[model samples]
Target: MQTRRRFKQTKTLSDRLADEAARCRAEARTLTPGRRREMLLRQARQDETAMQIEAWLRSPGLRAPT
Candidate 1:
């Protein structure tokens, strides 16, 4: 019998935010006009947050000291 891997790696914060944004956009596509607008706004905000997180990750201050 083959054993399945028991440990799963967790997603990073930015990845999670990006996934949420994508899911929100996909759900918005199925909604009526008014709800779609609200969902799109939420998706935009999530995308913005993901962008900010990515920027922070690239910031020099967070780098390891040589």
Candidate 2:
């Protein structure tokens, strides 16, 4: 039987996502206005959205489904 690989993550999910978004935005800034830059910007937006969702999901205000 093969055991699943385990790893420790030093950063929180939101932090990682935020970092990735920032990186994407920075890289996008270097590129001329085009598909690749647009794609990078889109990816950064996705990361930001995911981070927001993750934060919402983890909020203490979240209640269990009835």
Candidate 3:
């Protein structure tokens, strides 16, 4: 059994995101634990970010005419 490699991000978010996405696609071949976790975390982060943005949009100070 091989150990799953951990990736380090030293570049911009976009760059790191693309690299991570590529890794996830490649890892589907092996079904590695690390890749699964990474994909789930990435999805969670996206969901959280969207929620925050929606909340901000609904705030009185930022809300627009409906």
Best by TM-score, which number?
Answer: 2
In candidate 3, the residue pairs with backbone N, CA or C atoms under 3 Å apart (3 or more residues apart, or in different chains) clash, namely none
Each prediction's whole-model lDDT (CA)? 0.78, 0.98, 0.63
* lDDT computed for candidate 2: 0.98
lDDT of 3 by residue, 3-62 (tens): 999997678555555565556456554665676767766765665566566667767898
Misplaced by over 4 Å in model 1 are 1-9, 61-66
Clashes per model (N, Cα, C within 3 A) = 0, 0, 0
Clashing pairs in 1: none
How accurate locally is residue 66 in candidate 1, as Cα lDDT from 0 to 100?
85
For 1-66, candidate 1 gives per-residue lDDT tens digits of 999879764986677777777777777877788966696967768787877978888888897768
Alpha-carbon lDDT of model 1: 0.78
Q: Which model, 1 or 2, shows the larger lDDT? A: 2
* TM-score of every candidate relative to the true structure: 0.55, 0.92, 0.44
Residue 7, candidate 2: alpha-carbon lDDT: 98
- Model 3 scores a C-alpha lDDT of 0.63
RMSD (CA, angstroms), candidate 1: 6.3
